[model samples]
Target: MPISRSFRCSVFIGVSLDGFIARRDGDLHWLTSRGEAAGSDLGYEEFIAGIDAVVMGRGTYEPGRSYDPWPHEGRHCAVLSSTLPPDADPRVTVHRDLGTLLRELEERGTKSVYVDGGQVIRTFLREGLIDELTITTVPVLIGTGLPLFGPTGGDMPLVHLATRVFGAGVVQSSYAVDRTT
Candidate 1:
């Protein structure tokens, strides 16, 4: 079944000033060196308030496993990986494809999905499945790393919804996919 417009897939991530989401090694310490801004959650609390579940790629999941509090405990989490063991984590559901995972979420009456990870976001954008994007740009620039976006097959037109400055020099921008194009 086709996904209802009511069910939205949104990407909320903090990227470097140079567009890198993380270092080649996936180290995010640069993102935490915000000085006085380090303590702030920025708009993460507010943005995640609308998310019903999280969908991420294995690369994201592997590193996220070390997060002290285990971020997606209460929310349903789906990890896209064909090689990840089924019992990798009790809190997560593993799936090999996005369509099947999304259909299951739709059937469960999910309204919002938070799409995380660099590759996963690109995949969603390539598939034209992402409805919105909320990107937070940190003040530092990492010369080389995993970029927030890579080349899709074609140009994607975005309609800017809003832009705001969060604690320090961080900038957050929201955009809606211009499906009319």
Candidate 2:
């Protein structure tokens, strides 16, 4: 049985038309290049504005933590990894147990969290914790790469919320996870 969640988990990410989130080597060059040329955040600020906390797995952390200007500044960030490097950003709280992490966040009154990384998203989704998902599809398809989602053992339905077109051909769709069958 799945446990109940008082806090909300949300995913805001970009994907290629082929359904991959990044290249096979974890490179986001294709995705970043397009966004930079388009000169749009594609509603990222608004989405982050609603997020009180941030959680991601080691794969996302390894790359995201290397940026010069750290993302998710001023928010409590948590990294889900049991094998994280000793020198990981000291600002982030590392957790080996997802359930405990979620429980603590809920107890702290965290209303919403921006859940990132492919594996982390799938884990949360499988646990029936994700409340919403916003996927921005770029025009280019890189053939094969890291997919945005994977099998979760069973079907999880979504309620369509809205879709918007960004600069050029970027299409962003928002969906509410339908918990009520």
Clashing pairs for model 2 are none
Which candidate wins on TM-score? 2
How do the residues 111-161 of candidate 2 rate in per-residue lDDT, one tens digit apiece? 889999999999998888888999999899799998888887788889999
Per-model C-alpha lDDT, please?
Answer: 0.86, 0.87
lDDT of 2: 0.87
For model 2 the TM-score comes to 0.94
TM-score of each: 0.91, 0.94
Worst 10 residues of 2 by lDDT: 85-94
Write model 1 residue lDDT over 1-181, tens digit each, in one string: 3345457899998889899988999888887666247457877889889889899999999988889899887899999888899798998999888778877788778899999999999988888889899888889878999998987778889999999887778888999999897
Candidate 2 deviant stretches above 4 angstroms: 85-87
